[model samples]
Target: MQLTVPDFVGFVGVALVVGTYFLSQMGRMDVRKPLYPGLNGIGAILILYSLSNTFNAASFVIEVFWLVISAAGLIRALLLKSR
Candidate 1:
């Protein structure tokens, strides 16, 4: 199969998510930091964009929830920082 732009974008999203997890696992990044959820949210959005073209119901649902959860995490982090 040939690679497309959307595919590349999805791959980049995957890389961001995996990279964040790797960093956290290695103690290089904190999961509570804004960057973690930011990366996850961006990654989820990218995946959703790719899914819009491919149209997978399950993947779309999961990505939507993932983005929502990431947003919540980011919001929580910001609120905590402000306090």
Candidate 2:
């Protein structure tokens, strides 16, 4: 099977998300930092975009929640910084 642009995008998203997690585990990334959530949000969005062309219920649900959670984390970080 041949890979498409969306597939590449989805792979990049997976890499970003997984890399962030790996960094966090290695103490190179702080979970509370905006960068962490921002990466996650962007990655989730990319994955969602890919999913738009080939939908999967479970994957879609998880990505939706991941995006939502990342958004919440980013918002919380911003609010904290503002205070």
TM-score of each: 0.93, 0.95
Best by lDDT: 2
**TM-score computed on alpha carbons, candidate 1:** 0.93
Residue lDDT tens for model 2, 33-70 = 89999999999999998897788999999999999999
Per-candidate Cα lDDT values, in order, are 0.90, 0.92
The digit string of per-residue lDDT tens for model 1 on 13-37 reads 8888889989999999998889999
**Model 1 CA RMSD to the hidden true structure, in angstroms:** 0.9
TM-score, structure 2 vs. true? 0.95
Model 2, position 29: C-alpha lDDT score: 97
- How displaced is residue 81 in candidate 1, in Å? 1.3
Span of 10 residues, lowest total lDDT, candidate 2? 46-55
For TM-score, the strongest prediction is: 2
